[model samples]
Target: MSEATPPADAGNTVSVAVSALDLGALLCSRVCHDVISPVGAIVNGIEVLEDEGAADMREVALDLIAKSARQASARLQFTRLAFGAAGSAGARLDLGDAEQVVRQVLEDDRTKIEWSLPRELLPKNRVKLLLNLVLLAGTTIPRGGVIRVAGVGEGDGMGFVLTSTGTNARIPAGIEALAGGAVPQGGLDAHSVQPFYAGMLARDCGLPLRFALDGDTATLTAA
Candidate 1:
């Protein structure tokens, strides 16, 4: 049998086609990456407790286990809502709950969240989009900073603005292109799936998303 010739554009087509399975795998990887450290720390703490010679460090081990457990729980809760299928289709989510989860995952000694969203219900996807944006804003200042979240309007007209401020803060690399639905030059992976997913959520919510950099601050707006 003779071999058939391949289409000239086949390579280009395959390059940009990210299958649903690929996206799901990448997103799962991202969530795992976020929670793995704390999970591992908890295991380490358990190991230390099992070591009879380390009795002198029992207090430290207990503290580590407690802190790591909280961290793991917070990340899982945040991911459950932000990236998982939270609630039923078309269900509404309370912004108050969103604030609580965001605060749990993002606030620390070096990072702070200033949430100004009113206690109102919003579409589940919209709340998910806001949570993802808050995650993106938190990353803008890896050295630790403040994230200020504010909401505007009501119901279908709702919108949000989040600002990250800290020394050396700037927009995250490749976010603009990713948010615009372009696959990264380095190909889609855990690091790039988030912004792309955020953009998809914005489109589904019928909201226009934007990112801006001003001096030492980075802002994400969906309005």
Candidate 2:
């Protein structure tokens, strides 16, 4: 796997020719894609209830609708912290909020998150980087796993770590290359762009991302 740490453009520059609005739109598209299935299920359930005459079928449809709505809401909550502009200008985010959002995202997945940030607040940029790293690590454990996120040290000496372990754990192919500043021949789209985005966020936050993967375990450290 290729490993490189390139600096993101200073002053929040866009790496590509595309405008910032376009990039935001792309991220929004990704979020929409994720919630569409659950939202669609809810819509279908409502339609079924409206059309069906059988009370038992209507009850089942109601259950399906309730579950789907919860899933959609959770995804939206996660997206707000992970992708949306969450904090005010020059403000730190509450770690509790971050944990809550992370937990919500994990609710639907087989994976579990073990968060241990000793600090009560963190710079918004750091929180964004952390969430994105969690998102990246979440994709590695295909067969369910544990994601342990913790803060190490205190004050200026602080750093964050995310350790993912499970059966068949593996980083997605070409992600390391993307972090190393190599674009795939086919280019990146919504489905395969997150790892690259996380790398960029790390750079933007002036943090270095280091990863060590062996067998069914992967550890991501940022400082």
Candidate 3:
């Protein structure tokens, strides 16, 4: 991944060259890609439960169902805020709530989050941008690691920095361009839409976004 420079004027909207319909479709595809696995497990677990011959594995089936259900719920909740119209226009969202949802969605043995943002209210889009950045940072440490997030300021002047640390951690290919509002050579798809959307959110909030990689740490800054 390359470094992304902040826009000359933060107030200006970054041009994302994609149709609204295509953006929406790609985002939906991304969400489905995320939740499909656990959802499929849920279906499989139900099938097992409904099978009389599988009575001996009832405990296993139930455990699978419960775990899958929680995973599905967590993913949905995170996406609902990070990618959906979380509230009516001009609504405000609490950072505390954002932290909860992010913690839930990222709950797993391989990864950990250390969020240090205060429990303050911010415009819904800003909070969404923060969550999206967290999601993007999580991908850098695929081998499992820690994502440490901190607030840069407060209120309208707020920004964020997320640093992912793990063995062989790296910035995802093409993320710099995508998050800088440039269409990647491969074009926009479910896999690439997320960073693009994050870029859009950063611009919409008048916060320029940048990415850097140092050794085993990948840092994403939006300020």
CA lDDT, every model vs. true structure: 0.85, 0.74, 0.87
Candidate rank order under TM-score: 3, 1, 2
lDDT per residue for candidate 1 within 8-95, as digits (tens), equals 3223222266788998999999999999999999999999999999999999999999999999999999999999988899888889
lDDT by residue (tens digit), candidate 3, 183-203: 754568788799899999999
Could you list the CA RMSD of all candidates, in the order they appear? 8.7, 5.0, 4.6
Give lDDT tens digits, candidate 2, residues 68-168: 99889988987877777886867777778888888877744678888888647777777777888888788778788999998866553456888899998
List the pairs of residues colliding in candidate 1: none
- Looking at model 3, residue 145 earns an lDDT score of 92
Pick by TM-score: which candidate is best? 3
Instruction: Give the range of the ten consecutive residues with the poorest summed lDDT in model 2.
Output: 4-13
Q: Cα deviation of 179 in candidate 3 (Å)?
A: 0.8
How does each model score on TM-score?
A: 0.89, 0.85, 0.91
Question: Model 1, residue 23: displacement in angstroms?
Answer: 1.5
Candidate 2 segments whose C-alpha is farther than 4 A from its true place: 1-18, 155-157
Error of 3 at 195 (Å): 0.6
lDDT value, candidate 3, whole model: 0.87
